[model samples]
Target: MSSVNYYSPEGLQKLKDELQDLKIRGRAKAAEDLREARDKGDLSENAEYDAAKDAQGLLELKISKLEEIVGNARVLDETNLDLTKVLIMSKVKLKNLKNNMVLDYLLVAEEEANLAAGKISVKSPIGKGLLGKKAGDTAEIIVPAGKLQFEILEISR
Candidate 1:
């Protein structure tokens, strides 16, 4: 069975849009490539044709995987979420205990995680440690480097 993944409404919409694009534009491009390759030479000796066929296969595989992901995705209702504790889609303000550096991160699904954009995957070590933690609570997260401590300063939607 495919596991359900939670996404924000925008994220889910983005995924759906990508799937639609792949099914239409991507398939069209693949077909055109095959046609161009087939015109090059005979099937037995045509390297271009073989490469085009391989490319088409890979495109189909990508489309299949994306379809599966979109089928299993559920959008989270931001309005119904609890703001008192950290959870998926929560914007958390954290204070590093060791260095006392204040940082902010938005907890999101793995697919939407972008550290540069201040979004972190809920499945990540720090995200897991912050889960269910309320403001003023301290979390000790074990990372590859070592154990790090952070105090939850605030939680917001």
Candidate 2:
């Protein structure tokens, strides 16, 4: 089964760009490495050639995986965002029920999620719990530590 993931227009473009880079620059670099390794001598015991071939294989696998992600990515239009509830691409302000600490986060795709930027993946425990919730609603998220209760303070596009 394939996991359906959402992506903003910008995010999708980034994926395309990365794919292009891998197909072009990455392929060229791998070819150069392979050529240099082949010049080093015997194929049976050439560690450099083996390593280079392995790297090429891994690079190709990465490229294919990235292509699959791009092919399945759905771009979400922000102009039509429904602010009545929390959903993908929604920026939410939440308060911890126990500590009263407020936090802001943008719920996005797994690929776009960045904890340092306060962006959470829609598949994350907190994001999943927050989905479809409205302001004043409480979300019960199950994390590695335990159940975390958060009050939805605000929701925005």
Candidate 3:
């Protein structure tokens, strides 16, 4: 069974858009490729035809998986988020206890995690450690590099 995933409205819309594109443009491209491959040869000896079929199969599988993900996605209301503690969709400010450096991150669903954008998956080490922590709370987390400590500075939607 597929688990439900929570997303921001923009994130959900992006998934829906990708699904639509795969269903329409992606399928059209696959069909065109198959037609071209079929026109090129005798069925028994056609490598291009085989490759095209395999590509189409992979494409369909991707579309199916995407459809399932989109179907199970739920949009979270940003305006109603709790700011008292770190949670999904929470923008949190943290202070590294070791270096006294401040960092900002937004906790989000796994699919929407982008390190460059400062969005972390709730399942990630730091994100998991920060969850449910209120301002002024200290969290000790173990990451791949090593053990780190952070002080929660603030939490906001």
lDDT scores in order: 0.94, 0.92, 0.93
- Give the Cα error of residue 45 in candidate 2, in Å: 0.4
- TM-score for model 3? 0.92
Give per-residue lDDT, candidate 3, residue 44: 85
Model 3 weakest lDDT span, ten residues long: 76-85
Q: What's the residue-level lDDT of 128 in candidate 3? A: 93
Off by over 4 Å in 2: 1-3, 79-81
Pairs of colliding residues, candidate 2: none
Q: Score every model by TM-score.
A: 0.92, 0.95, 0.92
Off by over 4 Å in 3: 78-81
Question: Model 3 scores what on Cα lDDT?
Answer: 0.93
Residue-wise C-alpha lDDT for candidate 3, range 18-124, written one tens digit per residue: 98999999999999999999999797899999999999999999999999998999998667766798989999999999999999999998888999999999999
For each candidate in turn, give its C-alpha RMSD to the true structure in angstroms.
1.4, 1.2, 1.5
- Number of backbone collisions per candidate: 0, 0, 0
List the candidates ranked by TM-score, beginning with the highest. Answer: 2, 3, 1
Model 1 regions more than 4 Å off: none
Provide the lDDT at 49 for model 1. Answer: 91
